[model samples]
Target: MAKKLSRRLQELQQKVEDRTYQPLDALSLLKETATAKFPESAEAHIRLGIDPKYTDQQLRTTVVLPKGTGQIVRVAVIARGEKVNEATNAGADLVGSEELINEIQNGRMDFDRLIATPDVMPQVARLGKLLGPRGLMPSPKGGTVTFDVAQAISEFKAGKLEFRADRTGIVHVMFGRASFSPEDLLVNLKALQETIDRNRPSGAKGRYWRTIYVSATMGPSIQVDVNGLRDTKLAA
Candidate 1:
């Protein structure tokens, strides 16, 4: 284990110095991970896709350095019925109303994230200028439009990050970074992985967690295999 650890460390150091690392082949990617769990020093970004157009089993996960995403999310919740208090108490930037329509008209709405209950969809639907192009508009795919406001707000507060797959079948998330010690990165990664594993949509039709790799901003990719991670992958 020590010998393997030393070799892996040298390889990583060389890669960092040379900066020539590329995406790892499936098996080797997970086998040669940089940490046991993930790093804590860095923030994480999550990507998720809930397509009304597609079935389950098609989700994919790939990691990038948090440094690359360059955005810290500010969450907002549009609440009505009984959800207003729950959302505010959970630390969300919140507003509640049928009159929210008028509030958005003045164009004061500004935030990185948006969530709404079923009751307020019409209000949000009317505010495309305030929430649309910015990707702050919440949707069912992003888990922000739902009957449960409290649950959604807490997820945001806990750094529940999200992303979506593009035309090329790749989804990108920033799971901490190298500036973070291996342990910091590890924890963030675990949080991300478990969240996905537990949230399998009841109707999901394809493979989940298709693939995962960890890389730094402008860094090479390291595929992380949960089971094989340990002495062999750790730095000596």
Candidate 2:
């Protein structure tokens, strides 16, 4: 059965017309429609031409949002000896070696981002069943599996985000909060666009960009003009 839309959501939906909007205009509308009592996150849903099922067409990478993600990102590190201390000194919220793996195996997920050193990855691989579905599986491409644990933790805490095209060839990411100024949001969005373009897969053929949309966490989706977003240049 289809669930009914709330009265507030229904009214908000009416305000959005059936047409695409420029990037800035779409962001402004997204902010305006974010009338929830609490601060809402700004999210982007992008469709791309590449299919992720093929190895050559797969896309997995990270982008650093200049304005920073609105919420605090709790970082966890799984390493041994010196790397463990390195993570702690770099402000890791939780640091452990085998004990950390055991905690996660028993369903103790206390952190938002998990960083595992290269030496401990063999053990970390066993937790894939628990972490993969949640997009928490650390991989070299995502910058999560590395010898440089401290730098990885610092970057993730400072608004660095890992994203990839799903099996359906769509990318979904949270850029910032609705309370942020439209300019800040635009800067982040532009950065995302550049990152995706720069990471275009080898087998991606024909038109790479399909469509782009932005919306507040609970607000109606606002279509962003693809070309307009691509042409947008951030001020130096």
Candidate 3:
């Protein structure tokens, strides 16, 4: 069923134009259209021209936004011995070895991000059934699995995010909150665009970036002009 729109939402929707907007203009308009009582997140939906069936065409990576994500990221680390202390001192929300694993196995998952050291990966492997579908399984590419637990914890807690293309070859990431300044949102959005452009798959053919759109959490999406940043090398 379609949701019932509020008067504020109806009014906000009327201001959006039907044409593609520049990155800066889209961010500015998205903030203006935000009608939610709470601070809504500003997200970007990027469509790519790649086939997910091929392993080489898949894209999965992380980027640390210049302005941190307004939401606090609760991080959990799985390590042993000194590495546990390293994660704890680095401000990890939860740190453990076997006990933490057991807690998760018992259907207790309190943290948003989970990191595991290489040595304890063998033990962490048991939680795959519970974590894999939730995208919480530690992976080296996403920087969620590493020997340097401290660095991983600190980076993740400081707004480092993992983004990967879905089955339809689209990458969705929240750049920042709607309450952020237009310049800040643009900086984060451009950083994400650059990261995706830099990590363009080798098998991708012409027109890598198919479409780009930006919107507030509960507002209408505004199409972004992919060609608008051609001079800055954001051409697709």
Best by lDDT: 2
Give candidate 3 regions above 4 Å deviation: 1-7, 230-236
Q: Which tens-of-lDDT digit does each residue in 168-228 have in candidate 2?
A: 9999999999999999999999999999999999999999999998999999999999999
Each candidate structure's TM-score, on Cα atoms with residue i matched to residue i, is 0.55, 0.98, 0.94
Over 74-126, each residue of candidate 1 has an lDDT whose tens digit, in order, gives: 67777775677777777777566666557666776666667888777876788
Residue 227 CA displacement from its true place in model 1, Å: 7.1
lDDT of 3 by residue, 181-208 (tens): 9888877887788888888888999889
lDDT of each: 0.54, 0.94, 0.89
Error of 2 at 155 (Å): 0.5
Question: Better model by TM-score, 1 or 3?
Answer: 3
User: In angstroms, what RMSD does candidate 3 have relative to the true structure?
Assistant: 2.6
Superposed on all Cα atoms, model 1 deviates from the true structure by an RMSD in Å of: 10.0
Each model's backbone clash number? 20, 0, 0
Question: Which 10-residue window of candidate 3 scores lowest in summed lDDT?
Answer: 227-236
On a 0 to 100 scale, what is the lDDT of residue 133 in model 1? Answer: 61
